[model samples]
Target: MTRKQRVLFLCRDNATLSILAEALLRELDGLHFDAFSAGLEPADRVHAAALGELRHGFSSLDLLNPKSWLEFTSEWAPEMDFVVTLCDESARVDVRAFHGTPKLRHWTLTPSAHGATHAIENAFWQILKRVEDFIAAERRPWPSSLKLPAVASCTTDACDLLLSGQ
Candidate 1:
C-alpha cells in the first residue's frame, strides 16, 4: 500500500482558518492524508465558532486544538509532503525550507472578526471548498515530470497544479 501523504496548514493564529482546514481535510480524506495545522503565533484556545461548527459537522473534535508552528519543526515531527499557508500573514513569513522539502501553496483567506457568526461561517465554507479541491488534486493521476505553474489563486485547476510541484 502507498504511504499516506502528510499535509500541514498554517495561518497567523491557529484559532480559526487553520483549525478548520486541518479538521476538514482529515474528515474529508484521512485515509490518504495525515492533516495538521499550526500558527505562527498560536492563540490560547481554538475559536469558539470554529470549534462549534466543526462539532456540528464532524464526528470527532480530537484534532481541533490550536498549536504553534514550532511543533512541526522538531526532528520527531512527521515530514510533510505539503505545507499550505491559509492567510496572507502566514504566507508572508519567510522561513527556511521544511523537512522533506514539502511543496508549498498559499491560499489567501480573510479572517472573520471575533464573534462574527456570519463571517466565520463564510470562512468555514471557503476552507471546506479549498480542502475538497486539494484532495481532488492529490488524488488525480498526472505525469510526475509535468509540473504546473504555481498560481496564487485557489481555483480548482490552480490547486491541482500547485500540488503537482510548480
Candidate 2:
C-alpha cells in the first residue's frame, strides 16, 4: 500500500495560521492526509481567537500544543511528506534542515500585527480559502484502470479476517 501523505503546517508560533490549517485539513475527509503544526518558536497557548474560529468547523479534540520545529527532526521525528509554511517570516527560512526532504510549499499570510479582532478573523478566513482550494486539488480522481493500493486501509489481522470471505 502507498503511504498516507503527512503534512506539516508551520509559522512563527504554532498558534494561529498553522493551527487553523491543521484543523481545516482534518475536516476535509477525501484528502487522505495527516496534518501537524509547529513553529520556530512556539507560544504558551494557541491564540484564543484562532481556536474559536477552528471550533466553528472542526472538533477541538487532539488540538496541538505549541511546539518547536526542532522537535520534528529529533528522535521523535515524524515522517513528513509535505511541509507548508504559512507566514512570511517562517516561509523565508530553510526548514529542510529540520523537517528532512518533504515537499515544501509556502502560503504567505499577513501577520496579525495589531491583533485586531476583525483583522485576525479575516486572515483566518483567507487562509481557510486557500486550504480548501488545496484540498480540492489534491482530491482529484486518478485515471480509470489505474490500480493504486489503498494506503489508508487497515492491515491488522482483525481487518484481514473481516475482509476475508469467512
Candidate 3:
C-alpha cells in the first residue's frame, strides 16, 4: 500500500480555520492523509466557538488544539508533503522553517467570517468543505469520470456536519 501524504494547515491563530481544516481532512478520508495544524502565534487557549462547532459534529477529534508553528521547526514535527495557509496573514508570511521544500497552497479564511457563535460554526463547515474540495482536486481525475466520484466527495457525515451548523 502507498504511504499517506502529510499535510499541514496553517493560520495566524490556530484557533479556528486551521484546526477545522486539519480535522475535516482526516474525517473525510483518514486512509489518504495525515493532517496537521499550527499557527504563527498560537493563542493560549483555543477559540471556544471553534471546539463547540467541531464537538457537536465529529464524535472524536482529540487533535483539536492550538499549537505554535515554532514547534514544527523541531525534529519531532512530521515531514510535510503539502503546507496550506488557511488565512491571508499566514499565507503572506514566510514558512522557511520546514526547510522550504514542501508544496504549498492558500485558501482565504478570514477571521471576519467567524464573528459570532453561529458564524463560527459556519466558518468551520466552510473550511471543512474547502479542504475536502482541495483533496478532490489534487487527486488525478479519472478520465472517464471528469467529475470526482461521489463516494469520494462529500460523505453523509460531512452533510450532517455542515447542516448541523445551519
Clashes in each model (backbone N, CA, C under 3 Å)? 0, 0, 0
lDDT of 2 at 46: 85
Q: Model 2, range 1-166, lDDT digits (tens) per residue?
A: 4545778888898887788788777677425778888888899988888777766657643666788877777866887877889877778767566555787888866665325766768777777787888777665453466665565666698577667835
Instruction: Report the lDDT of model 1 for residue 19.
Output: 89
lDDT of 3 by residue, 39-144 (tens): 9999887787777777766744676788988777787776777889987778876667785477889887656665576788778767877877888876433335
Highest lDDT scorer:
1
TM-score of each: 0.77, 0.75, 0.74
> What RMSD does each model have against the real structure?
13.6, 8.0, 13.0
Clash list (residue pairs), candidate 2: none
Residue 150 displacement (Å), model 1: 43
* Residue 4 displacement in candidate 3 (angstroms): 1.0
Quantify all predictions' global Cα lDDT against the true fold: 0.82, 0.74, 0.77
